[model samples]
Target chain A: MSMVEKKLSTKTQVILTLLFILGMALLLWWADKGFDSYKQRVLRLIGIYAIMAVSLNLINGITGIFSLGHAGFILIGAYTAAILTLTPSEKAMSYLFGIQPWIKNLHADFFTATLAGGFMAALAAFLIGWPVLRLTGDYLAIASLGFAEIVRIWANNALTITNGPLGLKAIPEYSNIWWVYGWLLFTVVFIASLVYSSYGRALKAIRESRIAAESMGINVFKHQLMSFVVGAFFAGISGSLYAHWLTTVDPRITTMGPMLTFYVLIMIVLGGLGSITGSLIGAAIFAILFEWLRDLEQPFNFFGITVPGIPGIRILVISALFIAVMIFWQRGIMGREELTWNNLYKWLFARRKEGEKS
Target chain B: MNQEVFFLQNFFNALMLGGLYALIAVGYTMVYGILRLINFAHGDIMMMGVYFAFYTAVLFSSPPLIAAIVAVAGAAGLGFLIDRIAYKPLRNAPRISALITAIGMSFFLESFAVVVFGAVQKPFVQIFKTKESKVILNKVLMVGGARIPLLTFLVILLTLAIFAVLFLIVYKSKIGMAMRAISMDIPTTALMGINVDGVIGFTFALGSALAAASGIMWAMRYPNVYPYMGFMPGMKAFIAAVVGGIGSIPGAVVGGLLLGFIEIFTVSYFPTMSGYRDAFSFIILILILMFKPSGILGKKAIEKV
Candidate 1:
């Protein structure tokens, strides 16, 4: 009976995988054709966030590294891609504080600029990871948070490079649904494959018990560093995509002050840590809800009462929601389980069967 | 001012700032010692304390001293309430859950403050303000043509007094012994028939009272109170706690002073790099964690396999 079930599940998995791809493609196509520019922007944001959430899951979920430095990597990638892709005229216009001559002369096409951005971010992660990954638990969290703030400070003061917080503008809006979704698809596939491989197993082992994994001959530090670098690489790609999409990149946008890192953390936590499908769903829900919550910030008539706009209520609501979720459902929506067809089938039929037997 | 005067003045300023940080750092160190959880909302509790003082004194027309008393008491009460509501239930849950709840609570408090108090920076009624501006406000002693503000002297004195009181409480008191035991091993301490929950509540109350006192003093010094004002200082104080050896009380004070000196000296010497002053704490934090994870006063723990 178990053999038959396994075979049936394998066949079902193939069909479900194809269906999922087809559904996503159709959704993207419909969004591009049917939605307004504002709605389309939201869709694009969802895709970029999917990439970010998945990448962060690689570090925080799969590897159990509590890094709060996603904003720093995002800053690096955004600046790298923006500087590389900006036309000389655009650069001259944006850099009011005397552009660096070396950077001014350099420009690349969109694709190369993005790849280079990812590479630079990965390189930074590699260098920082060596010393940082040594620290564990809350210490690691605080240290990484500090690193992100340091990055923001650098961006604000490094006048020649980051334009001294005036920020980059008109960086050529080249990102669209296609670029975002393509990268999102690539990130999901890459991370899913990595999470199923031997290295991924090693990461999970380390997460469960560091000493045990070490005794089992698993190179704990090496696997952790690998996860950190890979996670940073994809985060960099997402940042590049985001920068191009917005046509603007600012130091404040990448700072902890704006709570960008917090939002990403919320996404992964709410979706369910250690689950790839959860990350995707969490990102989608976050993007949509974030946009939807803007209504709460604006003035609206309720029962003929003209309520005034409450400027910061959006974050207030989200933060409250985050607390509620943490207290009531600590394991989050997905828990450690994936949202696959086989799991769904087992949950639906097998659990009921067991209940009946009992 | 001459170079000598400038240096002396900055040094004095650093001392006062260090004292303020130490006061706040004590709260972080104590709670962390007992709970082994970073109460992310501790800073916001400080903010609440400041606002409480502001409303009591300015809005209700109470005296500054009375306001300070009420605010500190209120903060202690809020701390107890927070532990009972947000943290107590999660005592046996994963540490991450409690940490996240703390972060969420921090956000909730800040947002709630913004909604209630409005997001604008309000001018705190200066407790030190006097009718004769120059004689009292700028009252300073000249030593070799270097002037020292009286307020700085007062702040340091107050910090020292607070520290002495805290030291006496922690070392000489029976409850303090219970706190130490609980920090070492909660289960064993409970098994020994101590009221662990009440002791934990008292710990929160004591730590929060210190934070409140610091917050009121901070408002008096800075002359403004806003919802988000506690974030940077709170973060710095937490860093101080870690630097001093997170679970050690005296370690926190030393760490706070070191951080204060580093910040002030860096600004005085490298004026152009003053913008990067905030980054210095983080750099120091990372260095300390990497080289000495146990910190200056923290004992290294061995994990059981």
Candidate 2:
């Protein structure tokens, strides 16, 4: 009976997976054809945010590293991709303080530039993780935060490279739905598989207890560094998408501060930490809600009641809501539970049986 | 002679700043000592304290002494409430949950401030208005060729007094003993018939009060009240706490003073590199983390299975 149950479930799982892909494909086709530019932009942003959310989850959630340096990695990725993709004329126009001569001549297609961005960010994560992964918990968090701060400060001073505070402009708007969603899909699938693999189990073991994992002969440092580097690579990819989407980059602390890290952290937390599907869902909800929250900025009618607008209302609401979630509903939409095909099949079967009984 | 005066002037300025930083750093260290939680909202609480003082003196037309007291008291109340509301629930939860809540609370306070107090910078001035548009800022003293403000001496003296009182509390008082014991081992301390929750809340109050005092002094020196005013000083003070060995009061003071001295002297000596001054703290933080993660005065903890 158990063997028959397993075979039937596997068949249902494949069907569910195919259905999910078909639905997503339909939505993407609609997004390309039917949505206006504003709606399209939001869709692109959600995809990019999903990428960021899942990648960060790989480090902070699965690996349990509690790193706060995603912004620094993002910065590396953004600058690298932006610089590589910028035409010589565009670089000349943006670099008022004068451009780095070699970089001024450098140019690449969006694909190559994005890969370079990921590589550069991965490299930075490797260097930073070497000394940084040695620390644990809050110390690691602060050290990583310090790393981001240092990066921001460097960008602020590196006039020839980053163009200082002026930042870059008119580099080209190369990010679109296909590119953004494509990378996001790859990230989700890659991370989902990675989380279920033997190596991923080692990460979970490390997360649960470092000493225990070490005693069990798991190389704690190596696995953590690997996750950190991989997480950073996707972070860089997302940053590349973000830069091309926005067509601008700056070295402001507000942009690369622990605040952005917190935003990503909450996304994974809200989605349910250690759940890849949760990250995706959380990112979608966060991005859409944040965009929708702009209504709080000006007077608007809600169900025929006119509510006066308040400045900073969007940020205020998000922060307050974040606290309430942290306090009351920490498990979020999911609690380290993945929304897998098996679960979907079970839910559908349960509902059908209930309908027949009724 | 001019160069010597310049150095002395910067030295005095940095000393005063350091004193204020030490006051705030003590708040961070004390809370950390008790809770093993970083209390990320601490700096934002300081910002709120400044706002409290600003509103009281400006809107309520209160006396300077009354405003100062109100600020400190208000900050303490907020700290106690935050512990009650945010950190208390997560007492048994994972440390990461508590840390995330801390981060959330910090953002909540900052966003709340921005919404209530407008995002633009407001003038934070002397509560005691005189003929000049300045309070203590108007007064200056000359010792040798070096010019020093009276406020600098007052800040240093006040910091010293506060530190002495703090030392007395932690070392000589029963409650302080309780705090130290809890930091060493909370469960055992609780088992000893002590109210752990009450003690932790009280610790928050004391730390936040000190931060409020520092915030008031900081605003007096900077002469601006903004929603984000507490960020830089708060971050620097947290670094100061870590630098001195997070839970050590004396370590906080030493770290704050040393940081202030290094930061100011570097800028004074290298005007061309003043733009990079903020980077110094982060550099020091990384270096400290890499070489001596336990910090200058912090003892290393043993990991248990």
- Top candidate by DockQ: 1
Query: All models: lDDT?
Result: 0.87, 0.88
What's the TM for model 2? 0.95
Which residue segments of model 2 deviate by more than 4 Å?
A1-19, A302-305, A350-358, B1-3, B126-128, B132-135
Residue-wise lDDT of candidate 1 within B106-205, one digit each (tens)? 8888888888888899987554344563243457877667788776787788899999999988988999999999999999999999999999999999
Model 1 over residues A1-358: C-alpha lDDT tens digits? 3434522457678988989899989988998999999999999999988888999899998899988888888878888999999888878887888978999988999889999889988998999898889998888888888888888889889889889778888778788999999988889989999998998899999988889999999988999999999999998898899899888888873242337778888899899989998988899999999999888788988899999988788878898898888888877888877887876776677644334322
DockQ of each: 0.78, 0.77
- CA deviation > 4 Å runs, candidate 1: A1-12, A253-258, A348-351, A355-358, B1-3, B125-138
Clashing residue pairs, candidate 1?
A: none
Model 2 lDDT, residue A73, Cα: 88
Put down candidate 2 lDDT per residue, A1-358, tens digits, no spaces: 1323322466777787889888998999988999999999999999988999999999999999999899988888999999999989888887999887988999999999999999999999999998899989998988898888888888888899999888887768899888998898889888878888999999999998999999999999999999999999999999899899989888875675667787888798889888889999999999999899988888999899998888887778888888889888998887787887665655567344334322
